[model samples]
Target: MYSIDETYKNIEAEFKPRSKWDQGVKETALAVLDSLDMPETVLPDHFGSRRALLLNGADNWREYSYGGCALVYNVDIAARFFTPSEMRRYMADGHDASMAFRGEPLLDLQARALSQAERVISRYAREH
Candidate 1:
């Protein structure tokens, strides 16, 4: 999903496995979804969780910063629901609500994500 030039270098780093705690947190989150029979294939993957991780771990975010905000787009995930251009058009390519979640523990974030997912899914089921 990345261009084959300078982005390739960044891709190499992005593919690095999550550290131990991240791995554990992600697994537990996924397991929670599974326990509820909410398969990822059929459910939403919000940009919220991904955004927090990326920006919190961002190296020299200062390089991208302007007016204390930076344009941070995760094309790999956004492409699932929006094109890069569409994302920028809709402000999806910029910092968003998820920024408020910075410094939160992974488990706390996961619990909220799962709760939100469950609420949305349940609402959808009722309306449909």
Candidate 2:
């Protein structure tokens, strides 16, 4: 099982940005992730639990949000985990509710990411 800091560092080191703007975010996110202490668990296949896993042991707000987005996308990459219709509904409800707050776009994005986190949790609940 990977420690949070180790996983975070690994993830950061692995981040190959497509643009210069993302460099700062990637670096900052890695730093924040490094500072956290998270439980070792299977990565989520759904959105909700994925976000929760990302938020686990997060010390800073930005780290919490970034992790959520990263984890959600991780699930997204699986493709087979969620149907398009389910993903669409999940994203719509999640994004609107999450993005409603007044804050940086990152926070809004994090909120959107969290909206889908529920699916991950639901899947986990059934599996266990």
Candidate lDDT (C-alpha), each:
0.33, 0.43
Q: Number of the top candidate by TM-score?
A: 2
In model 1, the Cα lDDT at residue 93 comes to 47
Q: For candidate 2, lDDT tens digit of each residue in 89-126?
A: 54664455333223434344444333333222233223
Hey, what RMSD does candidate 2 come out at? Answer: 12.9
Candidate achieving the largest lDDT: 2
* lDDT, candidate 1, 27-95, per-residue tens: 333333343332333332344543332233333223212212222333322332333564465454465
The regions of model 1 sitting more than 4 angstroms off are: 1-33, 36-101
Q: Tell me how candidate 2 scores on lDDT.
A: 0.43
In model 1, what is the error at residue 27, expressed in angstroms? 12
Candidate 1 TM-score over all chains jointly? 0.25
Least accurate 10 contiguous residues by lDDT in model 1: 63-72
lDDT of candidate 2 at residue 91, scale 0 to 100: 61
